[model samples]
Structures are given as structure tokens and as C-alpha cells.
Target: MASGASDCHFHGNAVATQATVSTCAAKYQKDLIASGKIAKSWAAVKEPASFEQIDGEKGKEWKVTFKDPAAADKSKESLYMFFTAQGNFIAANHTGK
Candidate 1:
């Protein structure tokens, strides 16, 4: 993952072709895993899914924030995914240290 800073894009569901988990964020998580950004172990880190509306470069977008399992240090990390209301993957970020 591109640690620390956040990056955004306007992508589509076709770009998210690696969904292995069952959560709503699976597609986004799968993309991270496929790109070797996040570890495969993170596939187990699925919980605390929240929804929100954000102002995207194009317009408003739907964003989902999923909390990963605690790290070895007991610190929590989060995966933020932005998508269209139709469930297309737009962008994602893996935030943790």
C-alpha cells in the first residue's frame, strides 16, 4: 500500500477484479492484495463497515471505511474505500503504521 498519504482515483468495478472476501469492501481489499499493497492476511480483517458521502473530484461519492483487525502492537488500522452508489470501486487507502 502507499503508506501515510491518501490517493484517489475514479475507477470502475472492472478494475476491481480480485474480491476474495465477503464484506462490501472485498473488491477494494482484493485490489490492494492483488497489487501486493496489503498482505493476504488482511483478508481476515473485516469489520466495522461504515458508510458516508464525500465530495469527489467529479461530484459526490459513496465511501466505506472498514476497520482492520488490531496490529501486533495492538493499534488499529483502517481501510477506506470510495465507490459510486452503483458499487463501482473508485479509490482506496490502507492507513496504519
Candidate 2:
């Protein structure tokens, strides 16, 4: 199915600790993906993941998670997006039904 998801993914690596930003809010994330204007955004977003540090390196896991209960309002389908450690845009349905 074609959706505003799988837009970006950022693998945790040495270079990622520089403090990057991602769309952690489902509604805003989907909106950015649709408009292709995520980069130009300067909004309030917490995180789209959570993680556990390992071997002195950022764990290969999500350290934060983004969500918006309203996405389940039946009027909208939420989207998740982020940049991988390899620096690629990825958006997807993190909540696999």
C-alpha cells in the first residue's frame, strides 16, 4: 500500500551523536513526508524511537518513540520517519498492527 511512511532512517553511528532531528510526531511526520518539507521544519518533536547503549556506542535500537493518539481518530493514519546512521530518509508504520 502506498502511504506517507518509510520516508527516512538513521542508524545510530559515531557521526549521529552530533544531535540530529527527526519527526517523532505521527501527524507532523506524515505531513512532512507528504509535502516533502521535513527538512525545512523547525517544530517541536521529541523522538521517534528508544535505545540501549552498547559497547560505548549508541545501541542499534530506537532510543525514542513518537506518537499522537489522534492519529487513531479514524480520520488519519499516522506515519513514522527518521534518518538512518547511513543517512537515508525512512518513514514507516512503526506500530505494526
Candidate 3:
């Protein structure tokens, strides 16, 4: 489980992989989750299915305007996902476990 300001990795469809998450950016990483690019969703068959909000234009779009470790920049390479909240996988993006 990745934490603030650090770096973490979340497996998504073939579109994204860090080879390790540390090198990734926070914005891109959260995008994967919020955009429903997770690996679990890639599978055609499964015991259960899941999805991400992507914060539709009608609703609220996810933003990273403010955060701890203030050092986190939106321009980072986030190509993975992490848990932004507990038990809530959709919004969760890679944080650096």
C-alpha cells in the first residue's frame, strides 16, 4: 500500500506498468484508476466486476490541487493506480506502499 508523496504501483491493463511504480507520476497513476484502466477490468471473465468513476464531466472531476508532502506535482508520470480512500477502489490510485 503506497502512502503520500512516495510512489506505488497498481496493475492495470497492458496500457500501464512501471516495471516498478516508483518511477511513475501521481496524476497519470490516478488517471488510470479514475479512468477505469485497472487490470481487473481488462479480464473478460471474473467472479466479480468493478469500475472507476473517472469523475464524469457532469459530476466532479478528480483533482490534485492540494495534498500533503506538498512536493507532489501533477506533472509526475502516474501510470498506475492507488487507493485514495479505504475500501473504495474506484477512486484509489497508487500512493507508494
Candidate 4:
């Protein structure tokens, strides 16, 4: 997490605050770029296209989506990053599955 980034807090349970989740998503995106999983142009995107909480069979999860106009494939244009309720990264994919 970056300096002064919002801290994760608990509301009944250990759930990450939206700001904290957003920061996590951003860091994950940067990691993707560094690993050559995504275009370096992704670094230009300062914010996600959307952020939401998903309710699944296991439990709650956070999704941070970013749109990259420079992507070679339309299906790959949207990067979906998933994080646990506690702000721990789970996985990332273009399929959003």
C-alpha cells in the first residue's frame, strides 16, 4: 500500500474499505505490467473503470476493473482483478470469471 492510502477497517468482520481495495487493485495492475501480462500503457490509467463487491458461494469479494483502450483484443481490454474481503488478492483475468 502507498503512503497515506486509506486503511482497511472492520465492519462487524474484517472487510477492506473501498479505498484500500482500490489501492490493492492498482498495485496488482502495476505488477501485471511488470510481469508482461499486460500492456505497459496500463500504467497510464490512474483509476479503475468500476469497483464493486461480489457475493459468491464462498463469501464476499471485491472486483476492480480497468479498461485499456490500447489493448490488442477487445476481450482483453477489460482487466478484472479480484480481492478477498480482507483486501488480499485472489486472482486477475480478462474473463471476469
Candidate 5:
């Protein structure tokens, strides 16, 4: 799949490309901050620290990680957001595990 393309559909799912997943991850981060679910300091990190595709028991999953240097606790500095191959948000937490 081309990096410029938004996504590719297979079966009924819209499989997201790297660019598409990054956009989705950004939106999810913004929404979390807006909803007060996460610290506003997270906004300081404009870009994700990493993006990864994992093949697990449930199938393909996308992980977007952001490092918030302003976080009070070092353990909570890294925020990990998860999504489905289709770009659907799954969950988020400090521990990627």
C-alpha cells in the first residue's frame, strides 16, 4: 500500500496505512486531552515517538506511542494508544504490555 493513500479496504475493514494511522492517533490524543482523560502536558509532544504494527493472537494491531517529558511521573511519561488494523481505537495506557 502506498504511504500517501489513506487506507485500503479488505473484506469490510478499512486497513489503515502508516499515514492514516498517525492521523487517527493524533485525533485520539487530542480527544483524550479535551475530555480530561489525560494530562494536558501530553499536548507538548506534537509527534508520536513511535508507530508499530503488531501481529498478535487477535490479528494485526497498530500502536502509537507518545513521550510526554513534562509528565510528573517517569513511569507515566510514555503513553501508548492502540488501534485496530482498520483504524478503530482499541485502548490506551502507559504500559504497552
Candidate 6:
């Protein structure tokens, strides 16, 4: 679904922690597959995701960007997943026209 920029409150200067980010990304990808948005056979997201802290948000919160290989063009199918810093799924969306 199309989303407006106002939907999030992400900020610059994300926390630098590879372990935490990997864990969250794993869970987010799993949840996405479980939700049927991504096929299980695809097995993984097309690229690594970067994490960002949401200003004033409670709990560990991050915004991850990745692509579903089954989707259309990379530009049109770029996907975003939001997760709690502890790796809980929150929301997702597609970018591009």
C-alpha cells in the first residue's frame, strides 16, 4: 500500500549494533513470510536492511528496508519493515510507483 512520509517518525544517526539489527531483520523476514506477503521458498530478503531509531518511541524500534525477490522491479518493489528493537514485527509497506 502507498504510505505517506508522515506515517513514521524515524530519525537520523541510528544506533550502531550489528547483532541486534541482524536479529530484528531475521524475525521481520520470518514474520513477513508467515503473513504470506512473501513466499516461503524465497527464504530470504534480497538485501541487508539498515536500522534506524524512532525518536521518542518506546521499546526497541527500527525501520528496515529490503526487497522481496518475487516482487517487481527493485525500485518499484522496495519494501520497508518496522520492528521493535527487540525484534517484534510492527508494520510494512512498498515504495516506488
User: Highest TM-score, which number?
Assistant: 5
In model 5, the worst 10-residue window by lDDT is 2-11
- lDDT sort, best first: 4, 5, 6, 1, 2, 3
Candidate 5 residue 53 Cα shift, in angstroms, is 0.6
lDDT of 6 by residue, 22-74 (tens): 55566667767788986574365645546566632565556777656665555
Which residue pairs collide in model 4, if any?
Answer: none
Per residue, candidate 4 scores C-alpha lDDT tens digits across 1-97 of 3333343332445678888898878888888999998888889888999989998457999988999887878888889998878787788999998
Residue pairs whose backbone atoms clash in candidate 6: 60-85, 61-85
Candidate 4 lDDT: 0.81
- Global lDDT scores for all candidate models: 0.55, 0.39, 0.31, 0.81, 0.81, 0.56
Q: In terms of lDDT, which candidate is stronger, 1 or 2?
A: 1
RMSD of 4: 4.1
Candidate 4, TM-score vs. the true structure?
0.81
Q: Give the clash count for model 5.
A: 0
TM-score of each: 0.58, 0.34, 0.17, 0.81, 0.82, 0.50
Model 2 has a clash total of 27
1-97, model 2: which lDDT tens digit per residue? 3223243343434434313434323444556656766432323344454422222133242232444444434323233444344434343444421
Specify the highest-lDDT model's number. Answer: 4
**Please, what are the lDDT tens digits per residue for candidate 1 over residues 1-97?**
3321122333334222113122446656767888888667677865536777667777666677777555453243676777654445567765411
Q: Model 5 over residues 21-75: C-alpha lDDT tens digits?
A: 7887888898899999888888888899999999845899998899987789999
Of models 1 and 3, which has the larger lDDT?
Answer: 1
